[model samples]
Target: MTTNPQETTPNDWDTRSPDVQADQVAAYDAMRSKCPVAHDDYMGYSLLKNADIKYALEHPEIFSNKVSTRHIAVPNGMDAPEHTAFRAVNDKYFTPDRMQVFEPQIRQVVKSLVSKLPRNEVFDAMDGFAQLYAVRIQNVFMGWPASLEQPLIEWVEKNRRATLAGDREQMGKIALEFDGYIRALLDERRGADAAADITAELIQDVIDLPQDLGGPRTMTDEELISLIRNWTVGELSTVSACAGIILAFLAEHPQEQDRLRTSLAVGKTAEIAAAVEEVMRLQDPLVTNRRVTTQPVEIGGRSIPAGAKVTINWASANRDEDAFEDATTYNPHRSQENNLVYGQGLHVCPGAPLARLELRVLMEELLATTDLIEFGGANPTQNAVYPAAGYSKVLTRIS
Candidate 1:
């Protein structure tokens, strides 16, 4: 194995530093300008520029997604033929048709949650609304009962805390806790007559494998748990963060909020969706994704050898001035053709269609039901640290 000489260089930046954690996007932007390709022990190589991130994502053969050997992450943690097959199975659940059918339920879930918010009063949108909406909608989508809501919410918090602390042991225990929840659901579904729901369908789904490794086969309990866990991560973490970000953006930009509220009232789904995407692009909900090098490669004028861990800073890439003109400006009309919000290449987020639907429906209901959404109280918005994006506490008022 070739050792990367650059690894000996002192760290360019500390990702876990309180300064970076306080404002990840700003810190990354600074790094992108100074050192687009930075080496660090925590993230191996942090690619901050749009071009560098795009290059890494496009050339997944060199930058493998199998960052960890311990856990299986279904399609996300796989590459090539394996990723392709698993992704095929993963795509079936988030089809446009499935989203269309599921739209009303999502809206119903959002509406129910939105109605309960105390109008004209301050509330932590993250905990008070976004998290609740994310968990409830996920339960509805997965066919889980309402009883699992609180436990899942608590689990998400614990998982986030462990991740922030870089506590592998705690993360493993939390993963097992999550597996236990899904395992029970799977067992219950298997024993009873197959119900008409996503979870039930997943329980019966199978992936055909090449004859060399193994022929066609059903997904093992472990595989099912991993797949479900991936979905939950999307729903519980990214989606929830997106909720807080979107709400906070609207609160900060009342004019844009007014525009969306008007657009939504007239049933302008495309307009609302575009605006949501743009807002998310401005303040991305997802922070970073990991990739490990399979071969020596050069990126951003730096050489990295095989086995180097790479971190793709999505939040920074989406805001790269080289990629988008006036990158920070919120313009729904701006071309998103190169936006890395859902990512690119084989491993792009499969849950994007569902996430878009959820965000749009939630925003539409939020705008339609309330006259305004503005910052509440005198408390300043508190941004979530590394490993999480958006606000940790977004105090907002609706009237």
Candidate 2:
């Protein structure tokens, strides 16, 4: 319960400080030990400890996810009954039956990307495979065209830079640009016969709204666009980050990579998936999620007034020593019951099932295809800053 001097100050820690941006995991680790419930202007109260985060997640009533009044994030920004309805629509696309059918397509996407990589040559895995794999799979899943791939990748990069810069104007412009792309797709769908894909299904999906606002009705174009945007973010950025993180881990940890490769060879899909989860747990892809207090709350021995912004640092919480033994150590068999990799509670990522399936299939193909994976060239790996995780430039050699 050590109180930080900066806790009462305006900005406890600059979330975008050079040191933090350079290595967010280490910065968060330091914060967890020094001030688990730290306050700063950017992210009002950062809950670094596992306990505090778990409390925040379990009690969404106190810590609402409605952090933004400007933007609509589909179910992610909604609460309770409204969230439940929209979430039902969001969840419909990621069902087990859908994933079962989507598995081979995802595998083929991975295989096609991996096959193109030059053996024993130094290449940036993030650019060479991870980003492409993510974008390609997302397009295929959503029934988007191949032409959208490069533009989408460019959009993600610009959006990340704009967000990091805190350039609201640029961010808004970027959002509008993305909306243009999505709206075009939507327009195309509207004019033609209904396509057989998730995007088409979502376009036609209806939700039963409560009597207060409106009854059962179809979502407006704006709502549809917002929902797709949410899904796109999940698919492109988070998935890309996961791919890079998993591949980077495998490249560095040869023994574990070999073990995983062997496991995959023997058709041990579950084991492979567990290893992917563990690796990602050790180095999470998605960084933090925002929640604001609905009422005054006490967390990690710090009193937070009502309406205060709260940031749940998944990067820190997943590795909290209090919640996990040898938290930093990479142990695939460790129990993930308490792991918040995909998060916890009501706002937990609805795309978890799809993400897991994609990662598992990608890893399986990667391991089965390559004999050895190791650091490439002489370039140092460049870690992505806040709002993003994992290596931005992962130079690796696969043969």
Candidate 3:
């Protein structure tokens, strides 16, 4: 379904103003019903409807992922055969059984961070717990040195801050620095002839597949470096942001918090898990994913030219009125089988299992240990307009 450019209004871009943020759910409802495939520079070609997003993710060939560095990873960029190989490499490390091995370690990381809190006093969960814990956990997964964790965290912070500064050129420079760091790690892993971690495994084991893009069948140095940088950014940013948001939600809704506490009391980890999904659905940290048209296609009764960029606002689709009941409200008990937070179809987040593990462990720790996590100071400012959906300063009071 294509939309007429003349009829497509700029009013559709929900750019997260205070008013917009407050009514994002309402805005998405309107967009999905009235303008499912409207064009706007801010949101690209908006795919607000759940069906539309589902369609887009399913047909990766038409809606190609190979955008510029503003988006990274050859897999993230590639459409089909290329995308498959890269994703296969990632799945090698991110398998469900492999992630399950780290459950105890993830719990320890979460507990260790929470344990450091000053008893019954105020602190920023974003910094003291969420960001710090996310960084450490990421290191654990990647088999990176613990010593390098702070520097990597500081680098991502700088990259995010540069984006918030509205400096695209500066953001690129920061990205180069990040890529350089990944390259150095890749080099070390390749040179060292020893038992290696996942990162090392990627470098040593080449994907023996068709290479339409370049020379070798395997991932190039640049591609490997790119994947590492992208994985780190995606993992660190989303987990940190979601952690703070969940804490904020729990802090605001003591009734929900108590429900979680009592439910966990009954040894019902299932209930608590359901609550996490609800929180993820309501939070919906990611705004949208961009896709480029590889061929002419019609959507919403209008024709989009080949090579145009499209944006599927998952944040909006997760709140689609047609798909969700009272979409705005935080309903933890809301059925998890339908939510669009982790996206749908082929492009559904492969890191989802690890993300669930991390979220579960953190929530369990909060429920088992703390009396309450309260917002004491001003709300944390969102870090960026795209990708990294999180707080700038999230001050809090936890007891």
Candidate 4:
């Protein structure tokens, strides 16, 4: 879309304004009820309504995901036939059997960290807990050594800082720094037939390319690196955000916390996963995803032209009152059919199964280990600004 057309639309709302930056979810909610398809230079055309966002998600042919071509993003940055071939290979890594095999290692990671949260002392869950858990689990899945954990965590931070700064040159360097890490890992697994991790699988995995392209062949290093980038960013950023959100929610809501603990006592562990999803729906972790309209289309009574950029507001859409009754209220048992937490249709987060496993195990361990968790410390937690979602800090104390 960047190659074909540009965003010439006038601003309907200012996404960078103090009002929106202070609280993205609330601002988007207001936008959804008032002007569902607002536009800004930042996101171009923002889709705030559930129906409109779903329309874009389900109709990827019309609402293309290929928003840029300057850099590769594996299947996510590709469209249609090209995306389908790469996505097939991507989907295989997170199957039920794979998650099942990965659960014990995930539990080990969860336990090691959860044990470190000081009992009855104030701490930022995002600091010592959520962020570490995200990076550690990623290392576990990728078969990367623990020695890489601190470096990867630092890389994610630098990447986020670079993104928010709009420092492309620094972002490029940070990206290359990450690529070097993965390339070194790839080099190690190149001929290790005994390789049992997802990285090794990707090394040997073949993408069934269409006849017009090339026949089935192993993914190139560039392709593999891009895929890993997608997976790593999603895991580190959004998963940590989700963990912080869930922990913060439980700390603030004692009744809900006790109810979940009761559910766990009776072995209703699935409730932990349900609670994780429901909480994330309220304060969505993964924020906006971009698409480019392939043709002129009408959305939310607004006329959009071909080649205009579209931003799908997952946070707003999930909390939309029309989509779910009493939408803002937490309900773990509610239906998630329309939930765009992982997104919808094509380009949905491929690592969802692994993500769900990480989060569910994390909550299970925390709730099972702690007698109570509560909001504490006088320091006010800040809302993560636009382009970054979740709390910058979640102050809590465990007991």
| TM-score of structure candidate 3 | 0.88
Q: How many clashes does the backbone of model 1 have?
A: 0
- Of 1 and 2, the candidate ahead on TM-score is 1
On residues 294-362, what C-alpha lDDT tens digit does candidate 2 reach at each position?
A: 887778988887767788899999899998899999888989988998888788889999999999888
lDDT of candidate 4 at residue 313, scale 0 to 100: 88
Error of 3 at 57 (Å): 1.2
Residue 179 in model 2: lDDT: 96
Ranking by lDDT: 1, 4, 2, 3
Per residue, candidate 1 scores C-alpha lDDT tens digits across 87-135 of 8888999898989999988888888888999988888888758888898
What residue runs in model 1 are displaced by over 4 Å at the alpha carbon?
A: 1-7
Q: Whose TM-score is greatest here?
A: 1
Clash list (residue pairs), candidate 3: 1-298, 1-299, 1-300, 2-299, 2-300, 2-301, 2-302, 66-77
Q: CA shift at 52, candidate 3, in angstroms?
A: 1.1
Cα error, residue 276 of model 4, in Å, equals: 1.3
lDDT per model vs. reference: 0.87, 0.86, 0.75, 0.87
User: Ten residues in a row with the worst lDDT in model 2?
Assistant: 2-11
| Residue 86 shift from truth in candidate 3, angstroms | 1.8
TM-score of each: 0.97, 0.96, 0.88, 0.96
- 1-399 in candidate 4: lDDT tens per residue? 245243556787888899998888889888888889998887888898899888888798899888887888898889978899999989998899989999999998899898988888788888867788899888888888989989988888899998877799999999999999989989888764646778888988988998887888999999999999999987899988888888888888889889989999999988888888898889889789888888999989999889888898899999999999999998989998878898878788898898889889888888899989887777637798767799988888899
Worst 10 residues of 3 by lDDT: 379-388
